[model samples]
Target: MRSLRLAAATVACLSAVALLSACDPEGTDTGDSAASGAPSAVPSTPAAAKSPAAKSPAAKTSATPAATSPATPGKAGRLPAGVWVDPKAVPLNAALHWRAPGPAKVLGEQGKLQIETLCHTRRDEYHAEVAMVETASLGGASGDWKADETIASYGSGADSSGVIQTTYALMGVFAQGVKDCAATAPGAKVTVVAEDVDHLFADVTLPQADGSTVVVHEFLVSNRGSIAELTLRADLPAGARPKTAWTAPADRQALSDALGKPACTAFKDCV
Candidate 1:
């Protein structure tokens, strides 16, 4: 679970958030994965990832978002190389240059990560009729890296709702898990900055395998029948962070505003 495992594998996401615990010294991946036994047909979510208002900051992080600066929305009507939203196509700052999204893959509801396993709160038992996930990431090419993890999921109404609820619910618990884990692990810190019922934002700092540390900005959003996890990770940037100014595309938000938007008939519909 070391390094949050983002460097090791690219999605299918913040499970729109999945992450490994920092327990393993060798960085063996564990927990927060949506790929076990479940239908690996769609992309999942990651927010650095995985919290609530009580467990999160207010509506914004310490970093102030630029008022006049609007983020660029995803490409309209552009189907992704994968099934759903293109990671590279999300709302982003127009000033910064970014690398294209990596390949998309399948990831779904995962088991407990090593840190969660050590958590005092007992896990819940909730099941869904269909759970399909596909994941991908967008990032900078070098120095001052900005990496975004996009996890999108779709399925039956109940399952999609369940996924969103569980994701929001777990964010708080995961926040605590990070602190407890940080007690023993150096250079690992997680903070839930801002949140609402449908979305969450967190700032995370994790030590890398190469003895480096990276800062990540994250968001977790829940649509009626879908979930989106977005993140921006960088070493040191020159300007304001992006998530502070993030806004989903109008088309996507319009669909999410409804009962079930971004409807997918099958798993591949995401990938």
Candidate 2:
């Protein structure tokens, strides 16, 4: 497939007080490496509904932030045949510790959303996996933040070579989504902070009406045929923006790396 759009949340999580979020996108289905945002378009999930980086509808979550779980290596999980992630089994490593987890809602049989890349016009192309889940906490103060994580699994039947090809094709989708975002959002500064072959991190700052700004950082990583996304959405008040406001968080890289840990043994052989 070809040509992708990073549309807003289809069943995406919405929250102004969320620091982190997990979204499945819904957009163009022309597969093979697309955009990267926060919704569940089969091709992408990096931004929001209205603007390229607008406020998406967050998945249901707990009111308070969950405590950080202890990091444990080798805690890497196993991939059971045709089985997705187990909310109860996902261990909390120093790298991935979203203490508070919301209910996991799967979307894909209906249609997967796209994760737009490039920040220019909010148009991105990121091909997603089979099952997609968007999640996040809702309702909170402006200064506070919430978080969520979305993962796309290609399933036990995916070929490693195909998964590798898809990952390679999507190398620059997130960076492109940043450019697309800047094209539309006024005074909005969206930039790719860090990236590698299988992962990307970007920061988006949008000026608000009351002299405030919402800074969102999205981190995505791919393994085999799976993509795990960790996003941070924060509302910074005027005169309170820190110098590090536009930079990737200290643990973003680590968090992203730990996402596809202990590769599910199921992917070792993709004949």
Give the CA lDDT, 0 to 100, for residue 225 in model 1: 36
* Candidate 1 lDDT: 0.42
Q: Point to the candidate with the largest lDDT.
A: 2
Candidate 1 has its poorest 10 consecutive residues by lDDT at 62-71
Candidate 2 lDDT = 0.44
Model 1: CA > 4 A from native? 1-92, 97-102, 108-130, 152-154, 158-186, 235-271
TM for every model, in the order presented, reads: 0.43, 0.49
lDDT of 1 by residue, 164-248 (tens): 3544444444444445545655556767765556655566666655755556555555544345555566553343343344443
Candidate 2 error regions (>4 Å): 1-100, 107-133, 136-142, 157-160, 209-211, 237-253, 262-271
Backbone clash total, candidate 1 = 31
- Give the Cα lDDT of each candidate: 0.42, 0.44
